[model samples]
Target: MDKLIKGALQFMQEGFNEHKNLFENLKEEQNPHTLFVGCADSRVLPNLITSTLPGELFVVRNIANIIPPYRIKDEYLASTAAIEYALYALKVQNVVICGHSNCGGCKDINQEKAKLLPNVSKWVSQLDEIKQQVDFTLELNHYEGQHGLRSWMIEKANIINSYNNLLTYPNVRQMVEEKKLSIKAWYFLIQTGEIFEYCEENGHFMPLGEKK
Candidate 1:
């Protein structure tokens, strides 16, 4: 906690001074262009990876970057509410769901470890559908002993599932249909710091800058 406080103080002194104009301009409002749904992993820095500034991304971080399928209930819907605000109020033009390699959340989903944490278990229940898909793929590919490949596929599959869940929102669907919104899924290679963007027509994620 002390280290975090020190960093906050340092930011207010040196870091904030550097971006004073940008902060001042955003004092009253923010118009982030993208809603970045990413993992709560300490290692995955969304802004750093994307070369984006503070106000450029309205970030939603969770166990596995999980965005619940849009639904209404008596319970609080934190993820859904954030998405709604980003789309309706902030009017973000793009939604980026980023899943990283070696994600602990993905590993937990596969291993059924999230059950230990009651809230996390409920939250990550959304991954069960895709988790089964991964198991089926592993069975067909015989990747049982290949832990790395298993995790790699699960992480990417989780990202694609998040994109699918995001569409469950009526507003989001309407926005996409009208071309007012764009949704993208990304796989981040933690070891190499490379990002692959999903191409729906091509049916897979390709290197970020390579032309199809």
Candidate 2:
């Protein structure tokens, strides 16, 4: 509690003052280039990772960075609503679906730990459907620690699944087809602090700076 309060105070004094002009221009409206859909992990700082300024990236973060398939129902949809706003309203050019190694959400799905929380259990169940679509090459028994390599596979596959789901939206599909929007997947390696972008052609993630 004290740390958060102090952090806010520090931001007010340093961060806000340092970028006063930038924040002033953003007082009325914002124009962001990318829609960064990322996991709600404390360690995953989107702005710091991308080195983007305040208004450069519009963000949608959830338990597992889950973007539910586009649907029009009466229920309140936080993540889904954000996606709609970012697309139709804000008109962001790029959409990045980022997943990371050692994701607790993915681990829970494989290990059945999420069942303890019924709501979380329901939310991550969507990933289970995505899990079924991928052909996982690693068998759990082959990994020394069941959580390491095996969980990594699930994490990477979940990103691809979410990327596919993004295409289900009619506008997103049309924009992508017309080359008006570019959607890409990214995998973050926490241990090494490296980011890998998913390549549709090569069918795997490559280091961000590596030439295709």
Candidate number achieving the greatest lDDT relative to the actual structure:
1
Against the true structure, whose TM-score is highest? 1
Any idea what lDDT model 2 has?
A: 0.85
lDDT of 2 by residue, 55-142 (tens): 9999999988887888989999999899999998899999999998888777554345555677887888887755543324444445
lDDT, model 1, position 156: 88
Looking at model 1, the pairs that clash are: none
- CA lDDT, every model vs. true structure: 0.86, 0.85
Q: Which runs in model 1 stand beyond 4 Å of their true positions?
A: 109-116
Question: Cα deviation in Å at residue 111, candidate 2?
Answer: 9.7
The sequence of per-residue lDDT tens digits that candidate 1 reaches over residues 49-89 is 99999799999988899887788899888888998889888
